[model samples]
Target: MPNHPQPLRSDYKYLQPITTRWHDNDLYGHVNNVTYYSYFDSAVNTYLIEQGGLDIHDGNVVGFVVSSACDYFASIAFPDRIEIGLRVGKLGNSSVQYELAVFKDGVEEACAAGRFVHVFVDRASNRPVSIPEPLRSALARLQA
Candidate 1:
């Protein structure tokens, strides 16, 4: 595998604060690896809902995650205040690739970085659909 350097907070376009929960820690005492993915999902979806006007419950279109990945440079534990930084790496007709980084509060560098790909699809039919204009415009602001 190639060595990927951790990113700095300034590398991202948006930031969302997330509080680590007691349940997020594993027996090893660090935040479980799986939880990082949840953070990624939460940050992305929150942006879509708040800025893109995504109506999760009744919208005609919904985003389905098609791929995801993460790389950790350091451990995070419960009680840590985390800030997830988000940016758009690629935006397509029906899919968007979001690049994310997790920074421990007050830290300048990210402890973890990742990417998520979401494809917009028809809510009922599950067929891929073009990204709506409003959402596309909002996502464009995140481009880095």
Candidate 2:
């Protein structure tokens, strides 16, 4: 593995707790690799909805994830309580690059770290649009 920077809990601005379900584990007795992405997605959307006032159902603008990548450092299994740390690494006219890390609750070192990029777009037209003010303001607080 390349020497990617391993993220610590303190590196993130927002932390969201998530409970691991039994189904999250695969035949290997650990959380499947794909499940980590779901956690990342949930954490980001939760922040956008609760803090950024993103209206996923009826809003004129919606964010569509354009890119994502993850690096795993350790294993996690079902019944483990986890927290996902989130921060904005880059903010653009119509897109935001969110940096996130998954940690076993209360642990400092991240088990997995990832980046997710969302491009805000018109729901009907499906064309990119400038991020709305409310969402931008919310994202500002998460800058790292």
Candidate 3:
């Protein structure tokens, strides 16, 4: 498999720092494949809460993951601080595609990169809804 390309820190408008746990590693001594997705989730959600004012608990609109993809270029181990980069790719009426790149501290290259798509839906009805104004504004700032 080919590794994901790394984007420069200046290229991304938002970033979130993540700590890798011991269990995040697989028997092969590198971070497990699944853990990267968790980091992507955290990074994106954190940005939404801080920048988009997303209310995960009581918000009328919620995002559901409809698709995800990742490409690993290097190995990252436990105790490393992973700096996750985020940018908005496609902002649809009810969905947003977030691109993420994970770097092992200070590294200019990404150890892994991928995308996560969230479809906004009404919390009560579970039906698709347009992106709220506040959220849309926040997301637009991160457009790549």
On lDDT, the candidate that comes out on top is 1
Clashes of 3: 0
User: How do all models score by TM-score?
Assistant: 0.98, 0.98, 0.95
Question: By the lDDT metric, which is better: model 2 or model 3?
Answer: 2
lDDT of 2 at 102: 93
- What tens digits encode model 3's per-residue C-alpha lDDT throughout 21-135? 9999999998999989999999989989888999999999999999999988889999898899999999999999999988878888788889989999999999999999999
**lDDT ranking, best first:** 1, 2, 3
Q: Over all chains combined, what TM-score does candidate 3 have?
A: 0.95
Candidate 1 residue 55 C-alpha distance from true site, Å: 0.4
Candidate 1 colliding pairs: none
The alpha-carbon lDDT assigned to residue 23 of candidate 1 equals 99
lDDT tens string, model 1, 56-136? 999999999999999989999999999999999999999999999999999999999999899999999999999999899
Candidate 2: Cα lDDT at 70: 93
lDDT of 2 by residue, 4-71 (tens): 88899999989999999999999999999999999999999999999999999999999998999999
Please, what is the whole-model Cα lDDT of each candidate in the order they appear? 0.95, 0.94, 0.90
